[model samples]
Target: MGLAGALATPAHGDTKAPAVVNDARLEAAYVIMGDGFATVRIVTGAAGCPALTIDAKAQPMIVRAPHASLPLRPTASTIANSKPSVFPITVCEASLPPGAKRASVDGRPLPMPRPVIRRIVVIGDTGCRLKASENAYQACNDPEAYPFAIVAAHAAAWHPDLVIHVGDYLYRENPCAPGHAGCAGSPWGYGWDSWKADFFTPGAALLAAAPWTVTRGNHESCERAGQGWWRLLDPRAMQPRHDCNDAADDVTGNYSAPYRVSLGQGAQVVVMDLSHAGKKNIAADDPRYDEFVSTHDALARYARNATFTFATDHYPILGVTIPDGEPDKPPKAGNKAFQSTFGQVDKGLVPAGVDVLLAGHVHLWEHVDYSGNTPSQFIAGFSGTQEDAVPLPSRLPVDTSPLPGVTIRQFDAWTDGFGYMTMERTGARSWKVTVRHADGSLLRRCRIRGNHTYCEPIFG
Candidate 1:
């Protein structure tokens, strides 16, 4: 069956809920508000429906909880580069019942809000690519090979309080050849159908489990899937950009804004966008460079307020694993950007109380501890996407290792199977981070105290 046909077919024993106009069901499940109060977003494919009205009252697309009737609000704007502009999404804020284990959306049950947030699951770069010419190891058609479905299921089973996806949600840009395993008759363009197959469907379970803080990766560029990125995942207000064509230097519509997620008291996660800043020496006059600097300074100020602060972005600041076919040279521009902003050990540009720097892009996993730096850097991009060959242990060595006072204390890299990181807050000042494979096999575990990290092998 084709992608849309397959989705239209209901799962076994799933009583078909009353269909809105054009059979719109909930797509891209997410919680907007994090605390005890929650605002849920449900995207529907019903064309021209902009908001959902519950009962006879015309609600502004926001639904309050405790069994409220919701009706389709038929108003939505067309996305740039999208066909027909048929996807209209709505957001509803509801007060989940106390001690409620599950909540209902349009009569469909879903996991409820957590009383407290202690565990957070981090995954990234999970889009599946079907082109055989790309030389990916997994067979795209086989669910077992392209196991993001399984990965998302495992993550949902853990019942995390929150999910932090460091970006790259859509990937099926190239069409699959005839008779390819999972690609035969599949939708191949950058549209709602492709997104449903690549992300929404496989990610449904996890998306319903808890709220998510999403980052914008390079794959989410306007030229590639920017329209979908803005419509589906971005938490910020939408601002349409007409210049979303496929151009290498085009950075329009790339949201460079920085936002923060409060993780209870004394902790917060700050998300920044460095998608537009390419791996070249960004001139001081460049707006992207200026934005990066201002964002970095804002992160520094946030660090001072929170006892434990985590900064996440799509690009890695240090020790990036070179992609398979890319050149072996160091990332001069990325390094320069970091040095000019956060890597200034002598000038104290790196902020205090920032415990961790989480990033993804290189498709490998690494944990780097600096001798004098406040935050330990972690690369957890090995969620489900094809991984690049693991670089040598000492690959991409820092040019000026002992930069004034900063020194590389220790570094570990892994380029094997797909995996994710789970952070469990054990105490007010203590937390445990575990790196596990897609199937829940423990790979490594570490303890974080103040700003120091000590990790040991799980079975060594």
Candidate 2:
């Protein structure tokens, strides 16, 4: 009923620190690790308390009752309880301040003020259902058709508080090879079973292990027109959607629910949508263009005070290749335009708050840093897709002339060049984003800042 408190130690494995909790009988203290996924343990008198339910906001939390409360039962109180034990519990996921100490509930030593930790993982563009052979993409109908399980399992191995999935949740443009009768259906049609069978059921381990924040990509618009997206992926659907045309100036929208996802010490995640960028094939002059304009304005408004705002979208503003004469592309109207329109959106909207822009859609792995603009961009798509099997090298865009502060990191290896990203908050306003290969090798990394040049690797 009050502020749930925490007792943390400045250094790892410091037992001398006393527990800092108000009511030792009802409340417990935990020191969550800032490096990896942290675990908390709760115990009580006369036999490990069996009626306690310990849960963490970011990292998944479980309440263990000494295994003695056989059939550990939860009562009406447990059912009614929702808020984190106290009024305002301090969460730590970064680093421990020097000489930090607080009085425990029972005269023990603890981190005086609050308890928090660091380390958050950000990855996406996975959930593919195809096997590559003969340089062609074909569907594989087996026990484990999708590779989501493996990716999630690996994600668990690392243990991150937050998992940000940019887009491409469902594949609508999966162009099966000419003679491949595997994926026989409309280019994009998703049944509930199709999604669960592909991503949910198979990747249950990863999904259940952590909290996920997702966005709608172009593919979601393809099959059934964002039906599956609205049903499954969009968790914040009921909030409100924004008028995309006015986004560059406004901050909130009817479809866009502006919520502060905290990572301790004033660190926050500003989640937004790019679904209002008109339908997939709408003409440039269509009224939907106003939607794109609106969304851009809104993003700038929201980035005002965010320490490191990571913008979520289905499509990418900056791309890997320069449009060598194909002048007709999304990048033309996006940040790719030389006018620094994206630069303007980055500066005017996010300004000193926004840090990174993460997105998907192209179905390829790309990381760009538009530091020259405002907050840098990291286009991490290619979350492992069936399309990778087909040789669409021609369809892939090429950027002959590169941007000044941008970086290109791509992975075309095992299983259609599959993999995800690991975003670790190394500092208060700084983060280290590492592009991991499917095999767990570091492809590239970048140091993003709130108001500094986005430093990254230049991929060839």
Candidate 3:
């Protein structure tokens, strides 16, 4: 299909055609990696892998660099457990030619990286749940109920410079049974079809808008959907270990390394991976804990060079909603460990320069300001999926008795629907953050100056 035909073009009013289709030739959508160099990836379905070719000079121009016909090579391992088990992916890597305008992939135009980035769309936990048992909230199958494609179109309309997806791409854990709400008889499994329906098809428009920095979520674990994550989205060169049960040995690429990307205008974004961080108490002797500390310390040092720095991971260090059945207790061990290591500047776990820490895992939206001691935490986990409906108290006490003397002066939480945040760089040291609902309604607006943030509601 052509670029325009391949993209999920939304219809008028509240209805939309199913964005994802069963294209046997091209299964999952292509991903434009935001690495230091230019890269693109595509996965083939059970029709058997075809000779992939890229004509950089084709029409509907996508990239701004000159190039020739570049053939994509299949990386190490292919997605396992696929029904046909012949699903393979191909990647195309090439250095952009100076002053180049655009390029094409299989005759479809692909988006190129921006020379200067001013706005970014942040989304996470975006996956459609298929199993009826998993849909306790009855969110599956219904387009209005699970509006990932609608959300993607809305985000694409904004035309952000790039997108930062904080992980959890594939979520078709099991097949949908007959007579489900929105996903009746939907094909379910760890295959290209599921990946397309869950991510690529719904997110096709947004994917074509700009390059992306894809994070590693627990759902992308090797045992579950790790094969898809490793094949289509991951930007790292070296392949991760394929052993489903071995967690300690599955550390490579985005899993253990911290990627630093320059966003121009004296700003930078640091992407970290804590998917392997254990849930139990992480003792001082734990090598993973040590690695986490060391990684942040280095990132803290890296943040000092940029005027504004934001870090993102799949998990959150500070959360507004408590776990189910534990309403009156403190945060979990992993959360506490994260706070102990990255929330306290006096403890040298986090540095003073890092401005904000963006995370997604709890399936809710919250903004936790720590009085400038640690990075301000913003949880945008409600991008998609069934959200946690935990209620919150009207007021939270500000406790400054802890180390570094930090306290939560203000807190904002939302569980109404799926949404994403847009960060616009207003000045070298200032940014305006607007939190909007999935249907494009304003929720709140905040301004960030130095390490401080002030927000106010936008009432109709």
Candidate 4:
């Protein structure tokens, strides 16, 4: 299907509730929001999707679909090869009633979305860094140095009703050097072992805490961890994901249509596959520039019907980042691709109705409130991965511009350490967001009202 045709699938709004399921050997099973249905996905060593009993009757799980693993390059080195190793993993999925209250995998009770969601945990960039290209290797074995597991546990303990992971789930793209104590013995490949170590294991608690809404990150781009991402966490059907393993077609592989996940009462969350947008400014004549315009237009259309809307795209439409080695350099706006495409789509970038823009590519927690008009932007990329660069100034220069023609009225930026944010619904149109460090200590508290968000430190 063409990119537009592929995007026609709706996101969510099924009336059937979720129900209990039973299966042993299931590595992970949870309800996920996807195009037009609430899906039950499971990873197991077993060969096929397990059967789940729904409302006292057994129903077949996802029909067997071809696995998305690519044809391996057998000629490659036996160890530390550039190619990803195939694991004996069977990932299967099937749609389920959205209202089911109880679920279990391998007799372990799994989580389900609350009938009415009141609290949500948002996180992103959660993987141990073991990259050879950048010469960055984090101590995957050190809890203090790489605290995603601890952070996920603390996040689960908060008892969030729903969880949204912004992206960058797998980052161990290269093997650890023999003498490097930091990433010693870490599974450093694009295979399941790396994915399990970097994400699934560390984030197990939160994964089981509630239904998740996942956004695709650049790390999961076609050339990076894209293979593992499609096989494991993509919320879409298996078609485009299978295509993601190759550059056979145009950009449609990693990119996807925006879909709506209803928050009930007319409020919804629109998920955008912004994984393909690179840091470089795309020229007006670039083919991808037009594709991105369509992407942005589709997003605006999806949010038009919702009474309230929260948008999730891994690439920050507006964010602050510094040059790799020049931490002292002035902070600059990120995502020039979006700036070019969205600038042409709508002068506002996102349509005016989008209440909050949630993203996580920057590797820190930040919130920017605009003086004029625009959705308040929240960057929650500091969940687990090595926090990026040095800390941003407590106050950016008065003339700081995160996106074209957008003035920052006030903002709160934090990169002191690894952290996550929790959003608790305070009213129909308002939510209270709390930012916390890896230890789960409160850093900032903010209130949401329409497109405005104002934050203050928990303590002076």
Candidate 5:
């Protein structure tokens, strides 16, 4: 009998079932040589006798687990195939094996391996363009404008392990530039084939680089394409996937998968599809809208050290101000139709730990802060269009009720430019968000650090 078995044999009157923990919490096991980093080896099963050996002089040091368990099959430096693959797992310091030598429970070898690390990149509201002037705004989709190429360049330059596109991939009914033949095969406008040809083909360089997490915006509404949008991109459409809604008239009804991304250390990001009918193309008070909110509420409870959580959709809540007497009024309700989207964000996200909310669709740039001091929000979507620069208004509508330390930059100075933002981890618990122009010119930079707060703006 093995040591564990022998110990369980009992000496005399100890007749209680030998305690055996099958689902015991598992941590990391490390072995060090000299002063350098330790090399860890893990076995797959209980019999594997995974013995951990460490240098006598070297003591145990807590290291964060790098491996993150995923639902998909793991991808290990392998080329892309039709088959799916999983990312390397994440590991933490607590996961390490105890003691400086072989770890054996009564001589049973414990098996464990080093953790894996992954990189991630996030972008939103790319490719969708709406109502551009014939000649002036024509450059948006021009084959030469290299819309896809730009995305590709950014991907190549950063080489993120994964990509998160926050929606607005296609703008149905929005006429193509002057030259594009027509929306011929599109299901809504030209169909998936046309979109694949224009969007997928052009942006092939970047799309090919990483796995994608796609979200929906107002443009994906059925009113625009029936059920085409959901069919094309939803990972769980036909498969009875996770729905934040259940009852017929439930207020909480979400349509997308809830994914947690670990950015190493204790930091994690929980991404949710917050699209509700109330703010966009659908009717106000759409049950699905409530579902989106509830789903996020559930996620906010779990992600730890998640200093910041970002929500994305294709609508802007603050920033652009219509001329006092302008004839055209904003939408009455829903995401695309009006300014009411802010109410949804106010009621649903802030309390749930969302530090930043990203939106587009106004075709103009705007940033908002509900909590005057900490936690910032922004609307960055001037991509793929040609519009004249309009300065930000001096007087801005600031939501002071929440008082969550949020700030909105009322940029009266708006300029015609295609741009993207880069979020990088600069310190143990801080992220630097930099918004840049098409040519990589820095436009705005803010450092997000501690207790949902952002530092003063540093302009380019």
Candidate 6:
């Protein structure tokens, strides 16, 4: 809150509260995109909540939302699935107006949203893969194998005005096989340790560099890392059934209402909670299908009013993915569930007013342009997770489509392994995007004009 946050009377003699928690361990402090404002979030090891300054005066932060700024007890679901956490975590947040000028927690500085968002880093599906389902284990200690820290450092060095993690922050779900050196000793399960290792530890630099707009991926679904998603990044007020505490309440836990984040300069992003969406199509009769319809309707309303709108969901509605286990393997396609639901809702999948679509989950970088009044889709799913060993065809068929009406006008992809993407706003209606590898090596450069994205070739 360098200064978008205005002053609020300190809650209950907050001036007496210590602005610097000299005794508590400030594990993390960063700004994340709030519902309409910016929220200053901190994870501390102390039982006592720390204090922050809105301008020159200190204000005490309450517990987590809808109640106090306090931590929730781990439900039975977590008790049975995760190990006892070594760190005592208290997740707390305080909102600062979009115009707050100065803000600090425990005397440490925190970055604030810029008056004009000019540089943005888009990342997705970032984590070390440690899944027993597929018997896949990434070398967590190897930089080349799991380069999220490097990618984040590079993004921070670029001086981004804002950061958007498309989704899927947790992946160290299952343990490393006994004596397997690749992922030996790495934390697993949905506890604080797992989340710390998976995201917070690796993404420290970028977290401090700019405020983040967090998106939830399938990995963060109620069935997976949803518990941590709610505690740390879901960008919504804490609610009961949404905590992923019981299987009985999964219908509520999985589907969250969509909201918009207005970035200055006539640009806004509609964030959707389609983490429940995956490879299988959700039939129209299913109760969850209505959630997609609601999201589509909300996006239409948002797009109709904004000059430039971006639909940021974890899954790409009209993207090109390298499908795993398919015969030839180069059978590239888009998200099936979204295609089915959005196809029926709108002919182009994306509503008429949205200009850009940002997502991750395919574990690669892709840019797909369409033939009609369709939005361009950019996938930055190459952040860290190991990708399909089966590679995509060097050239994708352009006459084809992900759905019935959205014809592919152009296609581009790269990042054999880990990487990230950046968008630099250049004009009122235009921006330039760069695709970079884990080491920040430039792979492609593109320009965006409304819904169209044109990128220079990785080789040419």
TM-score of each: 0.78, 0.56, 0.79, 0.89, 0.56, 0.90
**Model 3 per-residue lDDT tens digits across residues 1-460:** 3322222222122133222223446543344544354455544432222222344442211111111121222211323322331234332233333245565444456666666688989888888765434443334467677777877888989988889888777666665554564666555555556667788888888888877878888777655566566556666542225323243444442255677767777788888877666344466665666668777777877787888888888877555556556877543212655655554433634576888878887787777766655567788888887776565554664442224455676677777788988889888878899888888788889887766676676742
lDDT of 1 by residue, 1-460 (tens): 5322322233232334223332345555466432223444566544222333333223233221111112221111123212322233432233333454554445545554454569999998888764334543345566666678878888888889889888777766655655566656665445667678888888888887777878888777765666566556665433335224333324557655577777776788888877655455566676666677777788877878877888888877654455335656442212555666555332544566677878888787777776665467788888877766546454445652424556666667777778788999987767899988888889899887766677776652
Candidate 3: count of backbone clashes, pairs at least 3 residues apart or interchain = 7
Candidate numbers, best TM-score first, in rank order:
6, 4, 3, 1, 2, 5
Badly placed stretches (over 4 Å) of model 1 are 1-24, 33-38, 47-103, 110-115, 130-138, 178-182, 240-252, 323-334, 340-349, 394-404
Candidate 4 regions exceeding 4 Å error are 1-24, 63-69, 72-81, 240-242, 323-325, 403-405
Q: How accurate is candidate 3 locally (lDDT)?
A: 0.62
lDDT of 6 by residue, 317-403 (tens): 877765656646555566778777876888767789899999988888888887667889998899988885355666776545776
Off by over 4 Å in 6: 1-21, 65-87, 327-332
Q: Rate the local accuracy (lDDT) of all candidates.
A: 0.62, 0.43, 0.62, 0.75, 0.41, 0.78
Better of 3 and 4 by TM-score: 4
The residue-by-residue lDDT of candidate 4 on 1-460, one tens digit each, is 5322332332233233233334466776776777555666778766665656565556555422333456442111233357745666777665566577666544456677666678899999999987775677889999999999999999999999889889899878777878889788888667778888998888888888888888999888766677667767776655733545555643666677778777776778888887878777889888778778887787778777777889999888877667567877887755678777888778777787788999988888888888576888899999888866567777777778855667887777887788889999878788999999888888998999888999999852
Candidate 5 stretches with Cα past 4 Å from truth are: 1-120, 128-148, 172-190, 225-232, 240-254, 276-285, 303-307, 316-349, 369-374, 385-391, 394-415, 451-460
User: Per-residue lDDT for 275 in model 4?
Assistant: 82
C-alpha root-mean-square deviation, each candidate? 9.2, 13.9, 9.6, 4.9, 14.8, 4.3
Worst 10 residues of 5 by lDDT: 28-37
What count of clashes does model 4 give? 12
lDDT tens digits, residue span 200-283, model 5: 554555554543445665555433321334333443312222221123312222355455544445455455555443333434
Candidate 3 Cα misplacement greater than 4 A, ranges: 1-24, 27-31, 45-100, 131-138, 177-179, 240-248, 251-254, 278-280, 328-334, 340-348, 400-404
Judge candidate 5 against the unseen true structure and give its global Cα lDDT, from 0 to 1: 0.41
Winner by lDDT between candidate 4 and candidate 2: 4
